[model samples]
Target: MRTLAPVALAAFACVAPCAANPALDALVAAYPDHLAGYESNDLIFRDGTRLPIDDGVKGKSFEQLLDAPDIKDQFAIPYPLGTANLRQPAFNEDPGRIRNQAMFVKMYGDCRKGEVKAQMKAVPWLPSRGGGTVMVTTANGVADQLAKVSRDLEQLPKEMTQYMVPSSGTFNCRVIAGTKRLSVHAYGAAIDLNAKFGDYWQWSKPKGGTLAWKNRIPLEIVEVFERHGFIWGGKWYHYDSFHFEYRPELIALARQGWPK
Candidate 1:
């Protein structure tokens, strides 16, 4: 055997950073039924369809991503999780908010075609707190995960219960306000908690096209939802505090040691 030589590590030598992040990786992994894996430059679907990782447009305006996003544009912003006071988010810190219409419609089905309702299952919301039932997708174990979230949230202090009970609604087959894009609520994978106490960006008037960020949803409630793989809308620059949708990508990166 030849004598082994000591090896010196270079400062620049490090594990190759994934072209796609762990957050994006978890998103793909979480939905194996819909996604296959990433090819060198695209997301491969189980059906052999490939979606490009980037739309090839640089410095897209916020309106561009909201109105029409390429599949990879969904990962443009990092979602901040847990309770941090509202600061004006960076120009486009709308994480989990840039949804690709084709990808969502393919996975969740088009509500207009009567395809979405078929996959929905009713989950009782804060049953112990006397909250009524809400509907969500049964796909990818979302309903089961939400049920777990409900169980844990019910055990929180009474003060926080006000924000969680009397949910505004779920499973609405409608476009997002002022836009043709389907709301995540249309997929039955999103939930809106109490509306009375929640803050919405649209409801407030901005002095000069920039609305002040505000939040009323308790951090405990947000933590419970994030723990169960749901991402809060309050984290968005266009914040909607009561909204929580099934977005494992945002939660996976923000929370440590999330299950794969």
Candidate 2:
């Protein structure tokens, strides 16, 4: 993994009040196949469509953002990288949780209409750890990035192997559980590790009005994913330890210390 230089860390420590970071910038720049750039609070598309950066709703409940989110709404919660496990996250600690359906569908193509398959490329999982082949999107070098992640992960200690290999799945075009919105998996840019060692909020009973946060995925594995422009669901308040999705926006801001 590339270490964060002390000077870079110092610059990253300062949070921008209402500006996009390099990670988001990278996402926009990387995906010229779909997007144009950001103009004020909107995501400009090459097709001349402008998607708002936020929904203009401040302080929304977690459920609201999930059910009804605008492009801007996706940034409502900041994703925390490199943090220790928490017993419980404050309500709405769902980083990379708010997804704008229109934005994603525009970029990745809606699978319901059978437009997603063309961009997919097969990638091998942790081959050294006995993992098999998995499919991911070739968009914005996603396939190449995952290959790099696989190569790096293979070099880790044997003890860290199980958490990464014997993979769960990749590239399923489907709605998220309990919602009509398509999952990142539909884009073929996300992966779920071994399900046996994963912890999901829906799988557990809620304590009071909140679900307890639990994780078994190692930080070392997470660092690898982040280095390759993926974000871990374990960082969410409604944590899913095995989940890692390609979300360069959050990763860039995280590197800049926006969502600490």
Candidate 3:
């Protein structure tokens, strides 16, 4: 992980007021157990650690944000929820893609160091579809939420089982492809549905050209997961239709009213 220089810290320390930032408000509200509040430019944790909200940079390219993002960078792209119509995401508009690594490490525990596996618990997948139990983190009630999601998904049409049955995976301790950054899976907060229907950016990438978005996951399934606080990767420009991560903050912001 990259560290911010003292000068950069001082520059972004002037965080905007809470009332003026619904995204920040949602973030604080989403993880009440770990976060105390936000002040000036720092996100105050319950443990008394203050992380700088921004990195004192503006007009950051998508690559830059993906490589080294602070808290505010996570909200650089406003997520659009309650929509099912298939459409292309604007270039590099990956809402939940730019995560604040330090913040997540603090909230979910580091997997590489064995801190994450300790908190993991098993949750049953679509039982009716014969999908067995999958392990996920218990942090932030993720296992509980996933249980709820599974129950709801099981109620879907029998045909939908093909897409949900035999879940691709839930928790895995590994970095993202070709990057040192830890994936959400490393923290046990994300899951991939059936691999047979999965669509990844790299696999679909044409030789040297713009990244195209493709998805086979049904909107009904996506809606069910979103209703339970999971954000679908299908919404990203670099789409991963089969992936969903527990990120209640983005859902809360979209529901309450995201900035236009």
Q: Which candidate number has the best TM-score?
A: 3
- Report lDDT per candidate: 0.78, 0.77, 0.85
Over the stretch 1-260, how does candidate 2's per-residue lDDT look in tens digits?
A: 12244334222311233365554565565565666566566666666677776667877777888888876666667666665543456765888888878888888888888788998888988876788899998876788989999999998899887787778889998989988889999988899998989999889998887778888887888888988888989877788889999887777766678744
lDDT of 2 at 244: 93
State candidate 1's TM-score: 0.86
How far residue 118's Cα lies from its native spot in candidate 2, in Å, is: 0.8
User: What TM-score would each prediction reach against the true structure?
Assistant: 0.86, 0.84, 0.90
Residue pairs with backbone overlap in model 2 = 23-252, 53-72, 54-72
Candidate 3: tens digits of C-alpha lDDT, residues 122-153: 99898778999999999988999999999999
lDDT (Cα, tens digit) per residue for candidate 1, span 1-260: 11122221111111133354564476676676777556456665666677776778888888998887887677667677776554667655788889998888888999999999999998988998988888988977889999999999988998888888799988999999989899999998899999998999889998687778888878888888888889888888888989999987667666654323
CA displacement after TM-score superposition, residue 69 of candidate 1 (Å):
1.3
Candidate that beats the other on TM-score, 1 or 2, i.e. the better one: 1
- Which stretches of candidate 1 lie above 4 Å from their native place? 1-24, 84-88, 256-260
